[model samples]
Target: MPAKKTKPTWTDVKKNLASFDNPGLIALLHDLYTASKDNQAFLHTRFGLGDDVLKPYKATLTRWLWPNWLKNQNTSVTTAKKAIADYKKAVGQPDGLAELMVFYCEQAAAFSSDVGLDDESYYDALVRMFEQALKTIAALPEQQRPALWTRLDQVRRLGHQVGYGISTSMDELLIEYGVDARRSR
Candidate 1:
C-alpha cells in the first residue's frame, strides 16, 4: 500500500522557519521576491521598497489617487474604482486595499475642501469608495478593523468641518458599519 500524502500548512511552514537565522530568513525573502511578480510587488509596496511606492502597481491608480496627478486627470470615477480593484487583487491583502481606499478618500476630501465642491455630489464618489472598502473588510480578522474605522472617521470629520453637507458626514456611514458615531457638540 502507498502512504497517504498531505498538503503542508502555514503552521507547518512557520514551524520550519524557526530553524533559520537572520541571513537565512533574508535570503528566503529574496528568493520569494524573485520567485514571482506578485511576491515582488507585495513586498515592494508593503515596505515601500521600490524607488516609487507606485512602482509596484499599475500607474492608473497612482494617477487617480494622488492629488497633484489626479488634479490634472480626466479620468472617470469608474476608472478610479477599477484601479483600486486591480490594486487590491494584485496585492492580495485587504489591509493594503483599505489603505488605498482611505488614501483616495483623503485626497478627495482635500480636493473637495480646496475647491469647496458641493458636499452632496462631491462626496458621493468617496462614499462609494468607502462602501467598496467596507466590502473588503469581511476578509480581514476582527481585530484589524478598528484602525481602518479610525481612518474612515478622520475623513468624515474633515468633510464635516468643510461644510460639504450632512450627507457627507461620517455618522450615517459609520452607523451602517455598526459603529456608533461620537458626536461633537
Candidate 2:
C-alpha cells in the first residue's frame, strides 16, 4: 500500500515577524493607500462624479475606516501626518474630491489604529487630517491630475472584488490588463 501524505502543520504556516522588514511594511502601506484611493475614484465615477453622487461612497468609507481606527497599533506618527496631508490635497477638486477625502480618512484611520491609537480622539484627528489632505490634492496641475484619477478607477474595480470578500489572484488582474500572466509577473 502507498503511504499517506501528511497535511501541512500550523507551525509551517506561521511567518516570523522578525524576518519581515520595514520595506515590506512600507510597500504594504503603499499598496493599501493605492487600493483605497482607486476604490474611491471608482465609486465616484460609477455614481457620476457629482457632489451629490458621492454620498454612498462617503458613507462606506467612513464605515471601513472607523474599524481600522480602533484596531491598528504600530503606525508611525510621520506617516499618519503625511496621509492626512494627502487626503486634504485630494478633497477639494471639482471631480471626485469627496470620495478621495473619504479614502484618505480611511487610510489615516487605519494607520492610527495600527499605531495603537484606539480612542475616539484618534478618529476625530483622522477626519481632520483627511480633510486637509483633500484640500492639497485638489491643487495639482491638470496634466498630472488625470493619471491619479485614471489609476484610481482601476484600483476601485479591483477593490470592489476585495470588498465583496472575493479573492482575485494577481493573474486575474494581469489578464484584465491584457498581460500574459505567466510572463507578466
Candidate 3:
C-alpha cells in the first residue's frame, strides 16, 4: 500500500518563500499580479478612479485617535503598552512608539490611495502595510483592543467616503464592526 502524503509544514512554507528563483515564486507573483489587475479594473469600473472629489482627512483622524477612542474605556495601560511593544518586536521594530509611527504612516498611505493620490503599485504596497499594522494592533489585550480597532474602522470608513461618497458616520462604522463606541469611550 502507498503511504499517505503529509501536508507541507510551516518550515516548508518558509523555505518556499525563501526560494527567490523558484517556479512557485513565479506562480505566486503571477497570481498576485493578476489579482491586483482585477482589483484595479473593479475600482476603475465601479468607483471612477480618475475623479478626485472626496479627499479623506487622515492626519486629523489619526492624531490621538487611539487614546481618544480608548479614553473612559476599560483597559489596562500596562497591557496596551506591552501589546504594542510585542507587536513592534514581531515586526522588527525597536519599540512600540516606533510601531505606532509606522502604523500612522500606513494609515496615511491608505488615505492617499483612497483619494486617488497613489499609483497602482504605491496603493497596493500601502494596503499590504496597512494589513500588517492591523494584525499587529489585533494582538493587544481584549480590553485595550477596542481603541486601535476603532481607529482602524474609522480609517476604513473615511476611505470609503473618499472613494465611494458613502457617508459612513463614526458611530455607524463602529456599529458595523460590532464595536460599541460608546462603551469604548
Clashing pairs in 1: 119-164
> Mind giving the per-residue lDDT tens digits that candidate 1 earns over 1-185?
99887898899999999999999999999999999876776677666576755444445544554336345754245666675665655554666777677666776666666666654654677777776666666467877777776767777777775674533545676677675434311
Provide the global lDDT of candidate 1 against the true structure. Answer: 0.65
State the C-alpha lDDT per candidate: 0.65, 0.44, 0.45
- TM-score per prediction, in order, is 0.56, 0.25, 0.34
Those runs of model 1 whose alpha carbons end farther than 4 Å from true positions after fitting are 1-62, 65-76, 118-122, 164-169, 181-185
Candidate 3 lDDT for residue 137: 47
How many residue pairs clash in each candidate at the backbone level?
A: 1, 28, 0
Whole-structure CA lDDT of model 3: 0.45
Error of 1 at 14 (Å): 35
Models ranked on lDDT: 1, 3, 2
Please, what are the lDDT tens digits per residue for candidate 3 over residues 20-103?
767877777567657864333333423435452111112222432223333553212233333334333433332243345345
Q: Which tens-of-lDDT digit does each residue in 1-185 have in candidate 2? A: 99996887666545553465899767764665578765454445443566664454454444444334345534343443443334334453444553445464545434443444444544444435433333444465545444443433343344333332211332243334443323312
